[model samples]
Target: MAALEGRGLRKQFGGVVALNGIDLDIDTDQVVGIVGPNGSGKTTLFNVVTGVHPATAGTVSWQGQDITNIGAHRIARKRLVRTFQQAMSFPGLTVDENVRIAWEQGRRGGSRWASPAMILDFVGLAPLGRAIAGSLPFGSLRRLGLAVALGVSPELLLLDEPGAGLN
Candidate 1:
């Protein structure tokens, strides 16, 4: 069974169609990329699959179980997490604190890296752990976001524009 699957997915915002009958399947440990020009439905697909936005039609499943519209929090609890196109973090908090928050709120299933510190190290942000999130450079901010997502120990991570800030 696929770890994540979207069948006939469709999302519409008023008269605008974001996604139209999209079908996708991701197996465990598989790396997939969705590429398109600006204004394409790439982000919309992530939003629907992650439950950040409801699909106008179609079904989403995780491990063969229907997860369509179940809500983003619930999906995250299932160990399915995602990062945004822009670096998303608590600007007022330190890098360490931001990752710690994700650890506290995220699902726990005993990943090899057990703590936020470990996650920061894994993402190559250990030296900057104490820095304010908003003060970091764009690349560092992106890494910080990755560290926070790692804090969740996600089974399947969907990175939206993962290289956006790195370049």
Candidate 2:
């Protein structure tokens, strides 16, 4: 069975339809990218599948289990994570501290998960761990957003416009 499936997914915000008759099946260990121009349902699709918005019709499933209409936090708890088109971080905090907060949110058990330092290192932001998140350049902020997403170590990571703001 596919790791993720969406069938006839539809999302309507009041009068406008964001997604109509969307269908997709993604197997495990595969990397797929969603591409489209602005206002195209790319982010909307992610939002629907990840429970950021309640679908007006159809369903979404993870590993054959129905997850349509589930809340975003609930979806994350199921090991399905997502990143946003805009930078998502505690701009007032240090880069390391921002990642640490995400780690705490995503860690599932008593055992220590990947350290914030390790994640920052992986994202090439280790050198700036102590710097203020708000002070970093746009490209670095994007990377930091990715690092924060990695803190969860989600089974399925959905990136929204990963390169949107990069130089």
Candidate 3:
């Protein structure tokens, strides 16, 4: 059985069809990429699967159980995590603090006060750990985003346009 499967998934935005009967099967420990031109429904598909948006039609199965309309936090508890195309950060927080927040929220195995130094080192942000996230360059912010997602310890990681703004 596949780790995740979508059967005839459909989503509509008013009169426009965002996803039309899309089907996909992903197995454990596999690397799959979804590529297409703009407005091809990639983000919509992720949103539906991750519970950001309810599907207009079809079913989603994860580990043989139906999860089509599960809430986002519920899905995350089930080990499915996703990252946005645009890097998101708490502008007022330090880089290390931002990562720490994610670590705590994602419920990774660690103390709430785990060494910020260690976490920064693990994500290659040691040098910038003390810097304010809002003041960092775009590339560094992107890395920060990845580090935050990694903190979630996801079974399934969905990255949307991870390289979108890279120079």
**Which 10 consecutive positions of candidate 2 have the poorest summed lDDT?**
105-114
Q: What is the per-residue lDDT of model 1 for residues 1-167, given as tens digits with 9 covering 90 to 100?
A: 68899999999999999999999999868999899999999999999999999999999999888999999999988988999878889999999999998887664566646678888988889999899999999999999988888887788999998987775
- Considering only N, C-alpha and C atoms within 3 Å, which residue pairs clash in candidate 1? none
Best first by lDDT, ranked: 1, 2, 3
Candidate with the greatest TM-score versus the true structure? 1
Residue by residue across 8-71, what tens digits does model 3's lDDT show? 9999989999999999999868999999999999999999998899999999888898999988
Error of 3 at 82 (Å): 0.7
* Residue ranges of candidate 3 with Cα displaced over 4 Å: 106-123
* Alpha-carbon lDDT of model 1: 0.90
Q: Between candidates 2 and 3, name the one with more favorable lDDT.
A: 2
Name the regions of candidate 2 deviating beyond 4 angstroms: 109-113
Better of 1 and 2 by lDDT: 1
Report each candidate's C-alpha RMSD, comma-separated, in the order given: 1.5, 2.0, 2.7
In model 2, pairs of residues that clash are none
Worst 10 residues of 1 by lDDT: 105-114
What's the number of clashes in each of the models? Answer: 0, 0, 0
Please give each candidate's TM-score.
0.93, 0.91, 0.87
